[model samples]
Target chain A: MRVFQILTTVSYGDAVSNDCLALFELLKTSGYETYVYAENIGKQAERMGVKPYARLQKLRDDDIILYHLSTGTELNERIKALNGRKFIIYHNTTPPDVFVPYSGKLARLCSCGLDETRSLKGTFEGGFCDSDFNRQQLISYGYECPLKVRPILIPFEDYKKDPDAETLEQMGGDTKENDHKIKNVLFVGRIAPNKCQEDLISLLYAYRKMYSDPIRLILAGNPSGLEKYMAKLKVFAGELGLEDIVFTGQISFAKILAYYRSADAFVSMSEHEGFCVPLVEAMFFDVPILAYSSTAVPETLGGSGIIFDSKDPSHAARCLHEILNNKELRDLIISEQKERLKFFGYGNVSEIFMKQFKEFTGQ
Target chain B: MSTAREMLSDILLSSGAANVDVPVSFDDISVCGASSADGYLESLEREFSDRAKVIPQYRDLKEKLGGALFGFYINHSVEQQNEINARFLDVLREFKANNDEIVRLSNRLKELESRMDDNGGIR
Candidate 1:
């Protein structure tokens, strides 16, 4: 009659997995008997007490289960049949159509995942979503359960740890001085079409041709199964003669942190996002954010960071130039973002989540 | 100055005025984008052609000082570079085909061996 968390796969540093682990930690340290099970657990997460779902031999009828629902469709389809007091944490799936030009396999999975989300209607006793956009999605999908929108839990302590020194020197140079002429603009997320990485490269092109030559665009994310998309972007970058654009494919958590630390401004041209957790991450690192206003992006920023309504690379480039070179503007954006970031602090978010979790599960 | 929007508008307006006199060329860009193989080279060629118009003026002077280096390298290597790249691509394709055949044959052998083991057990 304890608590159990389940997901199809749990990899370290993944936003959904991080949220699951955060809730698991909060539950455990607060004296609730909680365990997590995943079908395919990464080495780091498996080492951190996440069990193989195959090893989950028995579950009491009264046990509470929190399922992390993301893009993976296998567990999304199976969670309903598992014997437990069920609830789903909905991390919205990317639109399948966005991946059609890149990977058929991923597109099919996302198409099926959304269908499964609809099929999961009325099955759960309760539900939760990371953002209001996802909340509205669940509503449209007919999830008439007791639902709540709690901000994703971030482990700020992990971000505070020493970033990879090798990555630091490779990116920002050996010395941490403002004397370096290059301004590094960064975008961190999955290198998928919905993220609009091609626009990032175009922005860098505009920035270089129009404003300054000594600038860099670091696109740090996992492109594990999206080789075609990555190749196309690389070709595009080459076509533009943009040599300073980097597509960092599948980096370590510390290496990613180092990129954030090295970034002068965080810019996103994404067309779709569930919550865009990296926006908050940029805030965490004090990097001023200049993002295109899209679904859930404005909601996530909550009037904190600079949200522009244009997708013209020229506009983004000019704003990026001003943000990078103008110290007064950059400081104002960061200070505003810092204040907004407190809303997503682990202490604040975890408290709301834990309070709701216990109340819903009758713990 | 006060807000990002205001600051961006300021830059946009100022830059807009500045760019009014400069007409950005898209002719060479279209031809370059027709195929990735020729994109970079074609763009460079257009730039070189523009600069070559000045080459006639300093022909005797700069060519005497090893300034024919660019023409010498291009005339010597452009055709050869294309040939080499095509050859390299063909070799890579052949290498991939050979690897695929090897994997297929190995898998077939394993299947046959497994069938033989099954027959022996039955006998």
Candidate 2:
């Protein structure tokens, strides 16, 4: 059966884009014809060899429309025109209003909700949420559709081993003692308001006060219209005398893998998300995580990382210190994370997705 | 013919064969005898001159009338223009009275269309 996936854009560095790319690969392996529809296809889409359709009229009755959460009013008119089966895979926790705050007039005109749950009601046949927390949010908002809560899992790439002594020496690490002495913390995601870079900076400042040992905080990823916020973070870090914080802007996927292997732990203070892919990647690397217990963070972590209430910076700082100091606890979390990683394998996720698609199409 | 009145008479007599009844004094002729004739000539001359001068203005009015007539003919060909124009203002008043009924019937037709299954196809 042919499946048509609709998304907002195909840009790299977006979680939805990455997830859809993984899904496309999974579906293709199962011998299904997949086509993508968007306003414009990006570099990642071109690299992945996805064909674009300008409009939804090109879809046939045998097709299944798999709409990502980014589909808005543009899909509404086309969805009303479809003669095929439709399903929405909600990837974001909140709706369009949270993304674009100045859309009140448009929301009223289109009869969509300002909140997340209310907007999704009666519009889809079945939905696949990124987590059970999102599923509960939908039910609380009175959505009576057939909902499936599935955690996003992609196939794992083999962990790249640390470099040899000679290469390590060239890279300026402790090659002679065989100790990775640099206490590197990595944050890998978009730099946005909701990502809470400011909050993470505050936690970093507090961690420095408690410990005199030098820790290098690496803020990696593109500044997504939050350059001013990032600049403010850098200024604040300087004020707190923590200028050694490294801001490596957007890097290659290979470089990212290297950074994950090199870092001691992964940290994030994002206020909202449907799922955190970096946390999953951190677990894949057996890197212990320190994250805020908000939205989908706790659900994604699943007792695999150190969680702290985000409202209090001191609490977050305390969690960071414990995870950093205690080697036994960190090792235990890493081993548990390795066992849990089996469920997120590509074959398992693809099997579940295919069963749902077949049941929806009755094929 | 030989007197002053007869001299004026001789002048008219030499020009035509009609009788020339010249007044005894030229002033008497100017004031009394020729008063009605002068008034009649002056009025005729004024009326003829005014008529001659008004010919171009009449042509301009005719051109304006022709344009208005052409515009009205073109407007009448369109189905709704006559019902909207001020010249056909009675039609506009009639349309205002019946517009609500037309809208109500249109909506009713749409509602009926939606109610019909039509093989479960969307309209």
Candidate 3:
């Protein structure tokens, strides 16, 4: 039987797109006719080979199709009409209210996506959720079918593989003048309202106010669609007199590695997230993570990282200082994270994926 | 138009007249001036916070229209349109009442000024 994975958009460095591509590769190696489809294809995905989703009409009954449900899409109606066994891989949508002021169009799409997700009650045979948090959301939306929790299929080897040497060299050269006393705090995610970069600025402001030495905050993310929000964040930073903060909008994977390697602490103050992958990546690099306990962040951490309740600037600043200043606490946090990282290892996650997938598809 | 009390106070102070000690009431100031108009609306908003609460519905609609996403930018449904129109009409009525008050105050001040001028100012 054939297998097909469909998404709204497939872009490089995107978690959902990378997961779909990895799944496609896995299914292909297991001797199944697998196809990748999306509405908008990025250059990387186009180079990797993907087809338009309109070709879904050619699939037979015994085949299985996986729909990656994240946002509103025109393909929702078509996916519901599929003759083949279908499953929705639910990657929770951000709440519409979060995007209201920043982008009404985004807010509307989120609203429509929730409506679409709720409407697909019995259309699919079962559901696969990336986190238990998302699974609970599915249940809230009235999805009562068989469901399993699985991590995004990731090729961790790619992360471990030697980063682009030239990029690392460039980044390393730039850091040479540092007295090494300046703490390099990092947060890697898209620059958007829901990601709460403003909160990060507040935390930085408070941190600088209390600390003696200068602290560097490195925000590595693509801000292509959020120009106004980014500008607002820059203005806020300027207002706070923050000269050490860097917004590395859309950088290379090699640069990502260098940032991870150089970071003293991985701090995330995002109010919304769905299985944050950067938290795990930080753990992989042995970077101690201090994240706000919200949404799937605490669950994804698996009792590993430091989970704080308040995002109030002073409280967040103290929390950050405590994590960085105490060497023992930092080591203990990293040690626990390293153990938790094994839970998301390829062998464990894939076994979970393949087993549940086989039982659902009767392969 | 300045209130009679405001004009009297200005005239007495500028002309270095003796302390008249007139009773200064809220009506001594005109609410039609640019700065006073803003103060008038703020007082209205505070007094009738529920009316102020209705402002978000229109603001939200404007946001939806301004920040409309490409695919989700369908025309508003009849119910939505009705709700928007109702909120808009409510705002219009509120502003219309304020405008009427301003006009009435201006006309009253003008008539009072003509009477005072004919009588050669206050006795």
Top-DockQ structure, candidate number = 1
Query: Fnat per model, in the order given?
Result: 0.09, 0.00, 0.00
Indicate which candidate wins on TM-score. Answer: 1
Best by lDDT: 1
Kindly list the per-residue Cα lDDT of model 3 for residues B1-123, writing each as its tens digit. Answer: 542223323433443212221122222232233223333444333434443333222212334566465223333443455566567656866886887898899999888776785557853
Query: Taking the candidates in order, what DockQ does each have?
Result: 0.04, 0.00, 0.01
What C-alpha lDDT does candidate 2 achieve relative to the native structure? Answer: 0.61
- Which candidate order results from sorting by DockQ in descending order? 1, 3, 2
lDDT of 2 by residue, A1-363 (tens): 688887757765467777777788777877888777665578768777655544444567777888776434444444545656778787754443333322233334323422433555776788888888777766787778888877674656433534344423433343223345557777887665567665666666766665666566777777533344455555556556667777767766656666676667788988877788888888887777877888888888775666666345555655555566666666666766776666676677777777876776676
The sequence of per-residue lDDT tens digits that candidate 2 reaches over residues B1-123 is: 132222222333343222222112111222222323223333333333343332121113334587476755543444243233433344443654476578789999898788777686555
Q: Tell me the deviation in Å of residue B84 in model 2.
A: 38
Candidate 2: residue pairs that collide: none
Q: Which ten residues in a row have the lowest lDDT in candidate 1 chain A?
A: A172-181
TM-score between candidate 1 and the true structure: 0.78
Residue range A167-285, candidate 1, lDDT tens digits: 88787742235444677888999888789888888777776778644888899988765655666677677777775688788898889888988888899999998888899999998
The residue ranges of model 2 lying beyond 4 angstroms of the native Cα positions read A55-57, A71-73, A93-120, A140-142, A158-178, B1-123
What TM-score against the true fold does each predicted structure earn? 0.78, 0.65, 0.73
